[model samples]
Target: MAGDASNRDLPPVDVAVIGSGIAGLFLALRCFRAGLSVAIITKKSLSTSSTNWAQGGIAGVLDVDNQAALEAHVQDTIASGGGLCDEQVVRSVVYEAASRIKDLVDQGVQFDLSAEGIYDLTREGGHSEHRILHSRDRTGAEIERALTEGAADEYESGLRIFEDWMVLDLVRRDLQRPEKGVAGLWCLAPDGKVYTLASRCVVLASGGAGMLHLATTNPPVSTGDGVAMAHRVGADISDMEFIQFHPTALAIDSQHPFLITEAMRGHGAILLTRSEYKEWKHTDGFPSDFSYMNRYSTKGSLDTRDVVARATDTELKKSGDSHVLLVTEHLDVQEIREEFPTIANKLAEYGIDLG
Candidate 1:
């Protein structure tokens, strides 16, 4: 219920999983269901991972209803991933996206549905269609909560969960095991005690490596620990460059960075400039002159994240402005409030009223 000390003398389990993020939780559930004893070790509280802070919905083909849309989405992802993306891996993950969502739904993960009872999908900047399945704006939170609950049920049986257990290094016996075979690990407990956990199989689900940058939406614990550890053990790393940056972050002076959900833009918001504001104020009396996004892509505000962010940065530089504005005049004020209550509240805290 609280914490567990590692007893090196105790018998090793079938599998030892590091990190309790989405990847870890799902791995534990699958292993448990397969009758494999699992021990999950996390460096902090269970809910403190990057999965909890994820606001954008997962990309999947839930509503495509045809192969063309699915192929297009896959192609778009491949293009965005650059030439480095493995076509086989892309096809594998894309093909499984729908089944994965279905599995989540079967596991009691509640995805948002429209009034017509179809899975409510949203369009993100890089995406071609409205294929992202979500549960309101807190989609990741919802999924994590469900997975955690499911994991708890497994724990009720015999699954082991260790919180505040930071892994210092992995223990691999054979350095020449074809694919970097793992044997065990050396971890540091919250009390500064060292642990040697031996296992038949070891999994490193320790999330992304976003902390290397000055400004990252990733949590404090995401320091590329897993990647670093794996690399230390001679494991090959891939895609070290594909870091996605959201176009809108709350541009406030704070010790910690806060991300403004891109879903707000998907809901019909427009990025405006100060000069464009002045021009619109004198002419149309509404900010419509800041249409630089239209020059890049037909998706405009709904362009993929990389496109929109680049466009926004260009506009800010060209206009000699520190901050660009996102206007949601097309969206009903009350609807925006209801859909993005957290964002509206945060903006209000900064003396900017959404209404």
Candidate 2:
């Protein structure tokens, strides 16, 4: 249900937040807690953002025994960024990761724990330590669920959510004056009416522009609407060409490609050449069959995403194969099933089982 704002003529609020993703929802929550009225506008349902579809865990330096982990995390991030990274920004965000994680936990976001009750940290590409905080394989969904539910108590009273409301542009008091700041938004409501919602501050949290590609793992709503509107309002955009592509998106003969998370490799799943996979298809599956990753890099299957993705592309093109196989038959079946119930169920539909 959307476009159902009963009080169209309501007074201006303290903040108008566009998009209902993790960024927008968390912003709204903080503003409301500070005694500010918030209006959250989303183009579609509140739960359809890219954050809800993310499979990987949030990376942070969390282990106490790993005292050198913080600097290591920073260095790894910088290396992954390939000299384009802002060192100060990287240091700030990495150092503050623990507190932000604590904030999420305080808001009832439960991450996966080992049998000993410690965090079940897993290593993905470009990391030296296992510092990822995740809830099984569906970390993003878990985060979205937690934030959405946590904000429910303050919804009607403190935060006003406008779903199916397409934000067309940011409203400025003086369009000609460049120094004048954003005042609010001009949104096209679901009721086929363009309404002007006023606020002291307007926040654009609309997600990335992955939909610009014909084939992408990004949600359909990721049409780069936020960037577009920001450009129109003369916002200074940076690093517009540095979009990262996931290396192992599922390439089945489907219109929408599903992401084959890099975490699968973190859990000992192997990427195999089609010929190697066919050779093992008739025999009992073994780990040796999926050992092709070592041929590409010294880190083997644990290489950084860009490396792994480029290797996969190279192998596919070299062999003229449409798709490659991710082999997990050697991993413990029960562990894989329980740790990745969502992914297991999804593969089950395609007659593939990690178990």
Q: Which structure among the candidates has the greatest lDDT?
A: 2
Candidate 2 lDDT over 1-355, as tens digits, reads 3434566543588998898888998888989989998888899988889999988799998653565788899999998787878999999888888988887888788899999999999879888778888998899988899888867777756578888889999877789964687888888888788888889998889989998987888999999999988888878888889777888766678656888778888888887887887777778757554557778787777788878888888888898989887778778999989888888888888898766
**What's every prediction's RMSD, in angstroms?**
2.3, 2.4
lDDT of candidate 2 vs native? 0.83
TM-score of every prediction relative to native: 0.91, 0.93
Among all windows of 10 consecutive residues in model 1, the one with the lowest summed lDDT is: 1-10
lDDT of 1 by residue, 184-227 (tens): 88888776778788888889999987788887778898888999
Give the TM-score (vs. native) of candidate 1: 0.91
Query: Using TM-score as the measure, which candidate wins?
Result: 2
**Model 1 Cα RMSD, 1 decimal:** 2.3
Candidate 2 lowest-lDDT run of ten: 1-10
Backbone clashes, each candidate:
3, 0
lDDT at 203 for candidate 1?
93
> Which runs in model 1 stand beyond 4 Å of their true positions?
2-6, 63-65, 82-84, 175-180, 285-289
In order, the Cα lDDT scores of the candidates are 0.79, 0.83
lDDT at 182 for candidate 2? 82
